[model samples]
Target chain A: MSMLLLVRKETVSTRYKVVVCRDLGPDVMPLLRGKPELELVVWPEDRACDRRWLLENIHGAAGVIVMLTDKVSGSSLQVVSTMSVGYEHVDVNAVAKRGLKLGYTPDVLTDAVADLSVMLALMAGRNGGIGISVVQKGQWTEYPWAPFGFCGPQLSTTAASPTRKIGFIGFGRIAQATLARLVPFGITHCLYSSNPSSAPSSERDAQLAQKYNLQSVKRVDIDEVARESDVLFILAPGGSGTYHVVNETLLRKMKPTSILVNASRGTLVDSDALAKALREGWIWGAGIDVVEGEPQVSVDHPLVKEPKCVIVPHIASATLETRRDMATRAAQNLIAAILGGQMPAQVDLRGFA
Target chain B: MSMLLLVRKETVSTRYKVVVCRDLGPDVMPLLRGKPELELVVWPEDRACDRRWLLENIHGAAGVIVMLTDKVSGSSLQVVSTMSVGYEHVDVNAVAKRGLKLGYTPDVLTDAVADLSVMLALMAGRNGGIGISVVQKGQWTEYPWAPFGFCGPQLSTTAASPTRKIGFIGFGRIAQATLARLVPFGITHCLYSSNPSSAPSSERDAQLAQKYNLQSVKRVDIDEVARESDVLFILAPGGSGTYHVVNETLLRKMKPTSILVNASRGTLVDSDALAKALREGWIWGAGIDVVEGEPQVSVDHPLVKEPKCVIVPHIASATLETRRDMATRAAQNLIAAILGGQMPAQVDLRGFA
Candidate 1:
């Protein structure tokens, strides 16, 4: 038995190499460091991982943990773990072609993202961005507090009002979670547009409606979504297929009182068109979490300059608990893949293949 | 009979006088103007109603509709209708002593205020205010996006974590509505401190726990609220009894990770104490809708200068639908009082008396 164990130990890789693109905080870094069997190679800086450093270090890595900023395309990696729900930066096809497993943090961030989505919807509808700006700019004192001075559209429905229609660009986990939150606000109708390939399920829609006490929950086309939504959320996956899906045409169809929220990806919206729409009163206002060129968004950015647009940096999943959970998951994924165990959240890359 | 009818017609006032502090809005002005029996007397300016103008115009008015700025103390006014839920600015004793009906817009603004409360909570928890400020200040181009740079506390709970405890200073309609919105975020425990004179109902607590699928819902002392709360909301009515209730002592007792939200009157919290607490990291952060002497909150205000404090002018009920509803209710209240009918939302001042 001693000889057999010795032979097995010799057969297994003595020092498994794992590359971490960014420094996940104390709560998660210790998990990777405590492992004696793994040899860790980290980016060392507090900023985004340098592309050159990643490319150089990832050559012989068995596993790699990356953030949205890192592009993972090397074939040597056996597993690619991303610390976010969206994996648009990574080349899934290249990783999958090499039979590499992809791990991502998804369910852990659903609550955080969903909370912000609802918040953005409320802020946009109520002109909260401008309200805060006015106070911070020292104009609140001079501004007259009239009965209807700062009024914007409401997000909730009341007994005196008709049923409010809420629409979603993508009907996925985050959108569903947001809908669940809106139920208490007397939201009764829900409409969503998803990939046409996804078979429409009326039974599921009915179940959701009954569960949430909503009047109707239907899968609709993009035009119907724009036309009916009092507050529309763009929760679609970011990619070329969804790029500029909500442009001039869709913005024109929306009600003047409607509020548009982009919590998913900025690429799904046209910044120039949205600015034009807001300027021309095509829509009441907008609240955006991500922009097409974020971190690069300056004062000159059209969306940033739009008074009616409430643009926040990409901090939708910036809650401490959620980020810690994401880091923990990413570390665990790397550890599991190195030890020949099933990962907690492995992305199915068969579709990409 | 003809002589008697003519005598009655001559004795009864032909036109009922209503003094409006400000032009309510297009949606609401029509309701008052369309009435044939009521003669409207409105403040001529597009700003806050002038005290002198209000006093002069309200001398012999049968009803007066007011905003928070207007003082409704004249004896000749039979009804004082305010376009807000809070009546702290009004002299309730004087109105009640004169056998006057005090009408307020309550339920109409509940959803709007509740929505803003939740938005503030999320914004505070996620560092949304600072996040936006960073981008707006042109610091985003230079600031590196780290894995955990902009992270703050999470407002939700998950299976992997312990249940989030939500505490309310005053658990009234707005607080309850805010709680209803948080149910889906996996909140399993609730604590609240209301007026000590109010009887605690164990049965109601149990029912609320069961209805929301919460582990427990209990009324506790302020000390317990400070100690156990993960996210504490100041939703109590502002007055002498509640003023500075959450002072330095209470704030010191709160957990460093706890988030404080004040959507109620600013007097309920000691702004100086809260600023110190936030600066010293006694609590995670705070989100305040109403501040002490608001509209007067200057750029150098302590709370405004605190990086962790997310301050917004008192726009909690600034939604167009809510304002319209409030205007409609205020107009209706005046019309009802003048026509010798019960007001839709008349304040019962017996407790105060």
Candidate 2:
């Protein structure tokens, strides 16, 4: 037959596909539905997806929705718009090399994380961990009121401030939210030390300081951040760039009555160093949200065993309203990116230092 | 005269004789030693002296130091002065009728009480009680993550107006102290309900409010008091007249997110009603220093069982420094009153309603 006489075969339009590695709960499904053109394959398995399974099922995928348990590799990043702020699980270099857009839910969870930061601060500051243990172990009855019994360092906005100052290791979004919460509890000044290279503009710093009516808000050197703070918050980003920022040297520089709160990354802190600091009274107490190797940490962990340390499982962004908003926004971001429109909310991949 | 001198000479030369019902601990005894001439007779038991035993041994007492447990009755007002702020055990009306100068430690312990009030408020508002319970019960590991888990309210200062509403059930010295502590916490408006007859002049209120930069400080009716408070502190004096002032009707008027803190007296609140309110969410949470029938409260108590209610055994004035100060001041007050000079710090035994 002649070439012009032959009829061209019908070509099917390729749909944008996503692999939800593990099944999302009932609340998350409606958000992904009603987009007739997108294809979503739910694994329906509650366990972590095997590497082979993820690679096989992720063919021609432009999106990969994942929970904290998923291990997304370079091979799986054929196309993926992640649904989380911490994209450590996903192969970032691969995504960059493939020229694929990445999406993450960040600012939406700041308020919830901030709320939790304050919560841990209060709990640890008040000696709540030990106090409740006393109650549970039926010890309160035996030791009703021994003078100087069971009292922890109060987060005195006034008493602690005259000599002990408030400082932060990383002055980021959650740290700012925590400062906002602490202002009502009587914090007048805040000194912070972010990475020197990540230093924000003076105008933005001034705005933040004025916004909170802080006496002074400035980025200082790491040593100054330690020496001045009565309540030092560890809220830096994770990864090799900022690991072990609050080690023994920085901890030893703090006041004996100071409290340290970490609602940020796990690897950013040295737990063994923190334990020694707490035991030796280098710092009065510490409230840690992320341990060195969380999810594998046991009751016998040194940080958990330390009486002065308050260890909360990583739950800074776990409020009901906030989580829902995060999931919904994340889904929206993926859909918008695939639909050839602007994301309602998008994470700045370039901003991760 | 030397042939037949049989008159018994009273030990009037020992002007500094003191009888303490209980042993003042290491922190307090040093303050007492400041007055070297003063002789202190502590009870051997070091707990509490029986009323009859005290009456017999209190013959030559220049100062009678009593604890919350001792009952110094109308019959036992032979001492020159009684020492303590809460003289309910001392029978202060009888002391005045018997012409014994009554002294009390008031302003000295204001800061401690105020610090405790804010502490209780923060603890209750942040759900420290519940969180502590969870961590102690080993529930933290059992249920690691959930959407609506461990969420509590937060207090943040707004930039436009840096203030949160702070209300007191009664406006007294302790109430004023509590208010002072709250000022640094961004409290701008203070509402209170005092005894209608003992209400201070508007000018006095205005002056005090201006000193603290509070926008409005006024004595309001109980209904209005309950309706507008973000934190309603029960700091009123306790007696039959003020019993159950914060009952169901008043609690219902409070906001659903409001926090109730009682470092004042147990009788000021209706415990049964408070338990019901907490369970029903009439108010968000409560922190109680004094329970209705405290020291007798068991784990099965209704308020104790309620997740939102944090019951602290009355330790508002329990700081090491403050307690020592109080004890020393109490001793001074008793000594000053006994010597017939003007009592340094005397509580006017007027209508205590």
Candidate 3:
């Protein structure tokens, strides 16, 4: 049916134009192409959509689909879709005030991000960065065995560490999924600090604790989250409110044996402070996917050079499965909003404005 | 009580000495020191015990505690405790014929090895080696974001991939623990190939499936396991019988998108074959904590040079908690065997000889 309805350009081009900032790819492009009722203007590129071209072409379009950190200005858009879970929600409020409906690919990337989160935790906890460098530099041959060499704090529970406490700076879906992955590791207690605007959810916390058979899953203040957690995960959103939430003050309060992982936006953590923390042994180690001002991250970047910090390019949701799902979801979101139906993943911006 | 005992000299030194190949660290040395009844001669160096010194001092020892791959030739020992779970059990059989009581730290290192196994599966599946090198080499700056530049197979199950089939070469304690850890990743099916000498127990397999709520956990041939698994774990014992279990024929049968991880003995896997498979894209990637010849591994090693291979020095059980427990267990095992009573972790090598 989609093939038969392909590219039948109609009066909708004159009515409601949809400008896609980047080509969502063959699998998703087909979906966009099948929409005969809508005129599509998609940027044909292998890289990110060219900002100037996107902004110019998006003018007078009824809808637009773009990547993270992109904002639609000249477009008289009814809907905006981003292929990311995180965004500057300050722009969200501004968009909401303008009555522009937003669509985000959220639950799709949760598992991928959560999977990477646990990977980083294990890598950082086991001194993967340092160990890999030693092997790569051919130094493993010279310096090998010692009574306590290459030892780091074990992430899993053991006889020596029967009770495990895990904390999350932001207890969101991704954080919960990561917690689920660590269940068999025998983590006992969980404490988290969520957005201050959200109420402390005792009922939900109890449910979470019961779900994973944890000793306690409590919503505590940020200080308690820092002071007590054996493994702390930063899975919060990025914006002005959460900017540098894990600063030196919070990091200094953390257990020296603990590991800190930031799988969220880089702005949520202070890279210099985290580097300092790892250097000073305030925390055992850290694994971060997104560093503050990444892609621009050089070999000399403080976090990159830190032996205890396992820094990866912003590739948490870079799995082929997640990226494909994201593209399809973004296309579906745009198509749904254009044809006037219930969008699959429309963000609720009721309180934002 | 131990402090009061101190280091009282005993005439037992003339009758039966206790030779320790390596100083098992401060947390554990006290156990041996307090037992003044046993005259202890320990290797004072920080590295692995000097083989010559160990061999010379081990004569007529009542007990001996050593590391993996170490064997005593001229020692009259009642107990041989190794602070490792894996060994060349071929020697084990020869030692058993001499009625040598072998005690190894087993269950203590299972969780740590399992944790590293999962970490490897995640790392290899997500192209961690290539991604990390790119970042470390500063290539990440020039080549930032694309639609799917660094995309690899996602390890965790997703809506698009609701069914996951994980395979194991050897279904042992570490394999079971690794499976338990992967439960939350939505792996629906599991397949494994155990030792041909051991009978496949359907009852145990059924119990495991029921325990993890997996769709099925069945015992299959190595070829079938290789062909079907999305992620394959190598956790079998390393010895002559299991040497090169994952040869070219077995690897060629694996799925193109499959991931292979070796957290067990390196001898079980054919490194040259795996390097070929990865280079030719027979398998997506590999994560190996051990190699065929390690500690002597150079940057020129075929597996090490493979872009898709994530290699770490055999440090799967190299966590502080696990090491501490291993040391304590080794000390306890030696003490128990010498003093006469139940040994904590004596290996039952009845049929090996």
Candidate 4:
């Protein structure tokens, strides 16, 4: 019988296999060690997923745990699991047809993402980025105390009115958490537009609205969401289908004093369009956690150059406690799937299919 | 006719009759047009209460519209109707003895301060200082794509506890506005401590608390106030009696994960002590709008070096809308008092005496 093993020799030895397509924190290593009979092929080079290495090593593997950077396809691996909620990187239909179980970390990260969503919302509302840039660029002394200087939209209970509605571009788990934080700030209405077929359950939406005493929690058109919202939060996934959901046209519909917060993927927004929007006053301001072509952004980046925009380096789920929990959970999900058991948590593929 | 004109001649005669102690922007000057009987002393420098200038222009004036910087002493001038709520700078005992009807701008600044109190509380809880510093410092290179790096306490209601307990160091008008914001945050309790002689009316607190359905609207000892607060807000006036009220002893009594917001005054907190507490984990974090020695803080300031501390340059009443309102109200207060009418708004100092 054939078995899988990391080959120092040309021939494989007898060991059940799990392939880690990317390097995780060291805390995740022991989850594999718990099974003495299984072998783990972990990518030594910590980087964007090495396609060649993954293609070669993922052959005949029982399971593979991957990150967003990795593309898990039929040509690469089966029994795919991801460390994030969105499984856009993995070909879910291929996995289903191959009879491979798909594992992913979901509810475990709701609190962390929720925390960041609120942070970004507040940061955008407070003009924090402009204040920081002013200090960093040595503009503090040049600027004296002026009445209108450094004033951003004040997030308050007083902001709750019929005209100024709270909008969500894609209302998901983290969006709900953000709403919980916003509820206290006196937002009484909500408008959201998600994947047409993958909308939230009526019962769940009803419960959320009732719990917060909101006026309504119904789905609306994208343009309507933008037009009505005083603050539009983009909390959806990033993929080809949903790329650049918030373009210049949608942004122009927002109120002049409105704010935009993007704690999701950078590709969900077009940076150039957003930069133009900020410069031309299409929207009042934005707090962006994820930026297109980020981690490579220079001081002169278009969005960075805009005084009205606040850019954070994709830190939505980066709490110390939450990171450790994600690492541990991702490790457990991989281990459970390889050891003749159901995945600890698996992504539901019905919607994706 | 030897009336003590608190107005300076050289500066006041050139501009308007009232020497606006602090710089009120140009919009205010138009309100005093053609009031030839009244001379306005404008301070070219922001150091409005300069002793040399005050002594030189101390004779023959009807009214004065001063700011927090001016010290209206018996030796200097008699009638001081300041444009700010706090009259600690004015030698009130001397004013009382000299029979000067002191006017102050109190109610005008309540909303601004209260708005900032909540802003500081939210900023402190979210580690806004760290997030702000990180991006401006260009520290996004070393560990990019981090899932859990910068996270702080998020203020929200959960299933475990639907209500937040907001405690006030001083139950004044600003404190009540702060409480109003917390009400929508599912806050059900409001505990406060005020100077025994000037405590807020129990009937007013009860009625306001009942309007919001708060659990209790009771005055508590300082120790209990410190202990019970999830977000302890310091809104008390700055003076010797309330100095360093949140010292190590009180900080020790607070929850480790709790946040402290001081929009009131820097003198209310011990900066060095607060820095130590933040470093040694005595308390979670602090946000200060004012510091002990403000406008003189350098990069090496002790609180500036503390990561958890969010220090703003004393901007509690710094909103555009509020500032304009304050300037207009201050000028009106001076105009009204000088015309032998009641001050537009006055702080009753009888209780303090």
DockQ of each: 0.66, 0.14, 0.69, 0.19
RMSD of each: 4.7, 8.7, 3.1, 8.2
In terms of DockQ, which candidate is stronger, 3 or 4?
A: 3
Query: Tens-digit lDDT track for model 4 on A190-282?
Result: 888989878557787788789888887778889999888878899898888789988888888888778899988888898888899889987
Query: Largest TM-score belongs to which candidate?
Result: 3
Candidate 2 global CA lDDT score: 0.69
Model 1: how far residue B73 lies from native, Å = 2.7
Model 4 alpha-carbon miss at residue B265, Å: 1.2
Q: Candidates ranked by TM-score, best first?
A: 3, 1, 4, 2
What is the C-alpha lDDT profile of model 1 across A206-235, one tens digit per residue? 999999989999999999999999999999
Q: Chain B alone, TM-score of each model?
A: 0.94, 0.84, 0.94, 0.87
Where is model 1 more than 4 Å wrong at Cα? Answer: A1-13, A351-353, B1-13, B351-353
lDDT of 2 by residue, B53-102 (tens): 77776766666777665665433343533334565546655676776666
**Model 3 CA deviation exceeding 4 Å by range:** A1-15, B1-15
Per-prediction interface RMSD in Å: 1.3, 5.0, 1.4, 4.4
On the 0 to 100 scale, the lDDT of residue B289 in model 4 is: 71
Per-residue CA lDDT of model 3 for A92-124, tens digit only, reads 877888998888899999999999999999999
Local distance difference test, each candidate: 0.87, 0.69, 0.87, 0.71
- The TM-scores of all predictions, comma-separated, are 0.94, 0.77, 0.95, 0.78
Task: Please give the ranking of all candidate structures by DockQ, highest first, separated by commas.
Answer: 3, 1, 4, 2
Evaluation by DockQ, superior candidate among 2 and 4: 4
